[model samples]
Target chain A: MAKFDISNIDRRWIYITILLGALLPLFVPITFAPKISPEVKAVYDYIDKLPPGSVILLSFDYGPSTLPETEPMAEDIMKHAFINGVRVIGISLTEEGALLALKAYSNVVKEFENYGTIRVNYGYDFVFLGYKSGRQAVILSIGEDIRKTFPTDYQGTNIDDIPMMFNVKNYKDISLVVDISSTNTPNDWITYAYSRYKVPVAVGVTAVLAANYYPFIQTGQIIGLIGGVKGASEYEYLVNQKIQSNWGMKPKRIPAMRNMSALTVAELLIVLFIILGNIGYFSQKGNKRR
Target chain B: MAISSSIWVWIAAFLTLAVFSFLYKDNIIYKMVEALFVGVSAGYSIVIILKHSFVPNIWKPLFVSHNLLYLIPFLLGLLFFAMLSRKTAYLTHIPFAFLIGSGAGFALPLVFQTNVMAQVKGTMLFAPSHYPSLGAFINALIIFIGVLTVLFYFFFSRGEKTNRGIIVKTGIAFIMIGFGASFGYTVMARLSLLVGRLYFLFGTWLGILH
Candidate 1:
């Protein structure tokens, strides 16, 4: 048999072990305490404080590539907004995001329908304005004239034609702008919407993009922020709503939890491997010393 | 059995697991998953662009209404196919440059105000009235200090031997912690996504567990 090589034998074994650990959670769905940070809690409380019929604008700026993270955030925020009777106007910055946002809304709306209370539809209570180009330019223009940005809704109905557009004017009229985005357009909302228009801006950002907004959160330029899936799950927990589940708790949380279970075993294996590697290094060093 | 809408969910679940398998080995399985993702994503984007952008802005305006200005986008859209024509490939640059120029023109000022000006203005325009608690004050102070020191550390005029050395180091530490926390949180987030796929497969689709 060839000499046992810990470094280069095969990395697949480690992956298989990890995969098994992660898979165990699907069967045993355990509820765990989520460490809700102040930033996340602020977002929860901000939405909770809104009066019924307050207009909330949600920008779905992510494509299918980031659907796993942004979708749940969009879902929960929509669920919360509707449950609280806050009018939600869904918009998309990315062209692809329009479909994703619509799909997410309908998915959650169907679930919302199961409760037999809220009768949410496309044109009535919620309006999906679909994709608009010009990026930040659109955000800026909408502050002055929403009609200029959205001349027509997704279905070709003029803004004036829609009843919901009656009270909706500019960013000032919007109670909060929850930016569910992968890009930095949320910063534009903070600039034009929050800073310029004084509309409180909340962000539901991918985990990678969340840190950039922390400074804004600390300074109160952004009222609240939801960072990635964990943040989404945390927000879901606080609202007593299930947006997207089993992402963390099932595959990830279970593996992580099970990892804690077989942690001692893995630790011992690692220690043994490390000690052996060290011995090999030291033995070579001793030979050179002579 | 009916190849219902939920079958897409199952296909998605399987694709997710297949992609996750790459963590174990970068073999044919992972490559197949990667290729499938690339194909599906391209197909999806094409559909989205045609349905959402092309039809709404270009086709409807040009052919349906006979709007002459819509010809510009039509011509620009045609520029996308120039790359396929090897001899006239440079024509792609016209549209490319237009896109790049317009994208920059749209984004630059906004970036300047939002990312640079707004953030700086926010830092300077702080009021202590918001949070009366000492903890809030301390946090604000720390954030202010962190910003200043991190900025100073990049300054070439004053070397590490300056009076601000300790402050700079402390700032660096805070920045590092913030970055590290962000990174750790992101890892957990991605892990959550993988977990979500597994849940769909095991709990919802297969019904292996109650």
Candidate 2:
């Protein structure tokens, strides 16, 4: 083998390699099918088992910075909920998350419309409760009364006017709470909503925060979890396999699945670089010993 | 290659390229876009906070509904501005104290129940016999041992030399495994973000890929 010195490699070359690893997969046609983790499957099973018309509170707790990973998860969950006839009540605990929630809701609604099957009536089927201040306080207040916490929807329309708000009072009426966040909002949900109200909580978080939540899941404090884009892809795959089939709809191209190829390639390239660097280090050390 | 016609797409593509340019070298374009992002986000946050929070919760309740009870929170909120001045800064302490006290009081019990008590209860209630499958029983046993060893590692009172460093070594091994998993997930998270930007640039903006 030719002599190699990884330490002498330029940083620019590494960047170029990673850039190619990310970009080439986009141009080249390939499919990335990830094996669904048990954690992600747990989330799928919980939502799948919920009876029709059951209310699910989706807390969009992330901003644009984490839109890449969390948005796909949010969209997939919303799509699954809509397909299964589950009632969705959306809220954002963070100010930056408000618009993101609206965007995701609108995108999924548009997708449903494109499907030309079930038309979701806004006030009856779903409602965006909009953003509220006081992160943990808002969660606690939601346990008591949702209307009092969010007096109006995102459009300044009163919650009383919204037809769906009639029967929904608090966590009692809701089936589950799924928090898709980049922050500690999931922990707060577990603390306030799950611990106090006995409501089941699920989370879709950035991958960095995924391991932190495993202890909670092991303890049954959290019902399920979806982590990062891979987690989102798993959900998309499950929805297409199970939920979409029931709807008699063909499996569509999911953004998360499409992006997974690049993710895999980039990660593999990183691993290769690490191995090469280690080999070069050991080889240099052996030469010095000689 | 076909170019996008929409002015907004063009703008987005340009901004995306400008941001990506940072990978090669820092330039004025990167700085300009960075500044714009910060300014726009800050402005958007103010509007959102005003619309969703201040107007609904504080302003409308106090002025329109004429609820005097809202005055307490309104005044307390104003006390935050007192931090800007030295002479009147002492007034800020009252609100600060209330905030800290109320926040701590509210969070204490919940944290105890969810983070502490619930976790302990879960560990204590682990019954491998309850599992239907042998695989599940083994998994539960592994979890039980892992939790104990991890907890033992954190016990500072027991010196490492007491147990011939065996328990401490086991704890270190588990800790290393946890750190490795965390590192792996972090890499995946960052790669996912990169994939997102690439998707936007190629799939959404440029329409280079379908």
Candidate 3:
């Protein structure tokens, strides 16, 4: 407890401190470990049990602002689906997200070579349905008729032309609906996917939005949830541990792990700062009273 | 033909920058991009609705199958367009009411299954007799404590009671810590987008990373 003037500390310095603390880890490359909470573990296990050729509807319901947290999750989940031979039908709720989803999908598809073949391919193995709006209306129609919701892929190919959508009759046929969102889009998924059609639903949401979903997870509306990047990283870790062990892949646990490390240190510092500010304010009050 | 990569890169960079412009000030550039985003999204949604829902469900059955039953849904959809017509807008209420009713009906059963029943089942624990191992026991205890403590923090009815003061205090502390971590992580997540934007500018435009 040094008698230092806490009020004199510049806010910019704190931001700098946090920024450097976070970014430095990326280059240094220490092991970024996750606490691996039960909810995340459940999501990991559910996806693990999915058989190859199982249709998973992945809605990338996040815009660019949330890509930092959500992109890694989407990438990791798609990677798992690819490696496990699961057929992924990608779509987006927000218009801006459609291109980003495709870009991320293509990037993961490209990286598939470096990690070796996961026995999956685009069009044949997976499909991108692009972006559709109307929120719950779009999802409800999709439950009854997918061809009605998306007549073509983002590229404007006929839905029937894509082999992936052939067996995708309705939401009932979908194995799992994984709504990867930056906001509350998962609520709509729960209403339309699980409520209307009784399809199993999972969510990968931003950390801020994850708390509101506890009720859904509790009720069985959501089979499991991957909260933000950490959840995504955990899923990647589990999948890599299970299937990719023979190939010698260490898993891409970056982004989440590194970010979490910085976050922990920053939290401790901010709490300490807040406590010091309180102490300073109380002490000044006592002096004034005297 | 596919849109050129350079052209996409430029568009992405500009839109990304325009979004970031909100951090400084909401200028005409930001407004223009925002408006375009809205217009494009609205147009795209109309196309998707026509292709996905309208054609297969309404148009195809009406025109090809020549089924009179298809008229019900087609007319219902058309009624939704009545929302746009201010004079006869009250007619639009039928479709809106059906949508709300259907959506609510969908949510009720699911809310029970997923939120209430499933959660109750999930929380129903093992008889520690089965999980005699230290690690398993500790994990279960930690989860039990975390759940109860978090709940206790929200229960303000008996909050001032001194009997469970320590537990409540600990619970409140845990909640604060959780909030701190969540907030800090969210900041990093948002900042990461800014990082991605910077990467696009430098790596894609200036060829710095390459």
Candidate 4:
């Protein structure tokens, strides 16, 4: 047997172990039912309480790189909103998030039909103001007047032509502004939208950024946060629970929930490696001292 | 298990595998994909901006509608290109000044309110009287202590030699907690991204997961 040395171990071997740890759960699935955290429930509760036809301004502020985290969060929220008859006005802060938002909306809307829930019309019930440049400037503009910022929806149909546009003029008309972000755009929402316009803001942030927002949540600047894939899984569980109870069927696919198993096993494996590496380091140091 | 037949799925799977090939070693395939990603991103941005902003907001309204009012901002925006010439370079500052001025004019008060006043209020409002339960009181007290200590850690991160008091040590502990939480979350996030790709390959592409 080769002598085991922590410092001299092949990087490939470690990478392979981690990869196997992540991959094994996908093959023989380990189900992890996410426990809804207080922060996540705060967001869910806020959205859950909105009256039918109330508009949720969902800013898709993430790119494809974070689709694993943000996309499911967006989809879960949109599904909840649709299921509750709460309309969503999807916009994108990041350029890539524009198309990503459109894709998410389309996916949810397709599934919405089968829920046999209330009809979700494109122009009337929901509308996408789409991507506009000048991220902070666009957010501030939307605070003042959304129509001036986005003359047309993503499809280039004038906002005046859209039925829902008549009722939604600015932040005042929005029931909630949920910025799903992997960027600092949520900070802009917190500062501009919530601070100036006094609109309630919630964030669905990538897990890495979640720590940054805990203080903001404490200050009540943000109503709640859905932090990363784990947060998304918790949210999916919550949404599916309510949705299933109401309709007697869970949402067809739970991607984020599936992700939890891999996330758990991978973390556990990495922790074990870290512990073993530390033990080996101390043991080697003791030998040197001797 | 059946393999995915869709061309898009095949393209995506191939690109994903190509990117993952970096774990072994940096090769031409990775380089090619990296360049391809950048080019596609740049091209995508141009198409989105032109289709969404320039066309609807400026181009159509200026030329088709013959709206001369749009020309003011348009001409100001064009001055940004003046940076190409030495003498005309200073002209770029005109629009830059407007942008900065207007942005500051709008943002100054709001930023103060959100970042300062709100945060301060959240911190300072942690009185024991406000808490109805022992647990709530302890949580609030802990938060109050954590916020104060961590605020000082910001100065510590700048390499300032503050007084070596228990307060500073406490702040260091709070900072470590924050860092640990952040690191743990980052690990979960990166792992989730990997899980996503692995699932795409195994479940979506190969159908082996089923």
Best by lDDT: 4
Tens-place lDDT per residue, model 1, B9-100, is: 77877776787776755778779988887898789777877876677777888999999998997899798899998899999999999989
Q: RMSD, each candidate, Å?
A: 6.2, 2.4, 5.7, 2.2
TM of chain B, each: 0.80, 0.88, 0.75, 0.91
* Model number with the top DockQ: 4
Per-residue lDDT, model 2, residue B93, is 92
Candidate 4, residues A40-72, lDDT tens digits: the string is 999999999999889999999999888889999
Q: What is the C-alpha lDDT of each candidate?
A: 0.72, 0.87, 0.73, 0.88
- TM-score of model 4 vs. true structure: 0.94
DockQ (0 to 1) for model 2: 0.79
Tell the DockQ for candidate 4: 0.81
Q: Give TM-score values for chain A, per-prediction.
A: 0.81, 0.96, 0.91, 0.96
Candidate 1: regions farther than 4 A off: A1-17, A65-68, A155-161, A191-198, A241-290, B1-10, B71-106, B124-131, B157-168
For each prediction, how big is the interface RMSD? 4.9, 1.2, 4.4, 1.0
Per-residue lDDT of candidate 2, residues B4-100 (tens digit): 6779877887888899899889999999999999999899889989988899888998999999999999999999999899999899999999999
Per-model TM-score versus the true fold:
0.78, 0.94, 0.72, 0.94
Q: Which pairs clash in the backbone of model 1?
A: A247-B192, A247-B196
Candidate 1 per-residue C-alpha lDDT over A209-265 given as tens digits, one digit per residue, 9 for 90 to 100: 887888787657888898876677677666553223311222222222322223223
True contacts kept of 2: 0.89
Candidate 1, residue A138: lDDT: 76
Clashes of 1: 2
Q: Cα deviation of A5 in candidate 4 (Å)?
A: 0.8
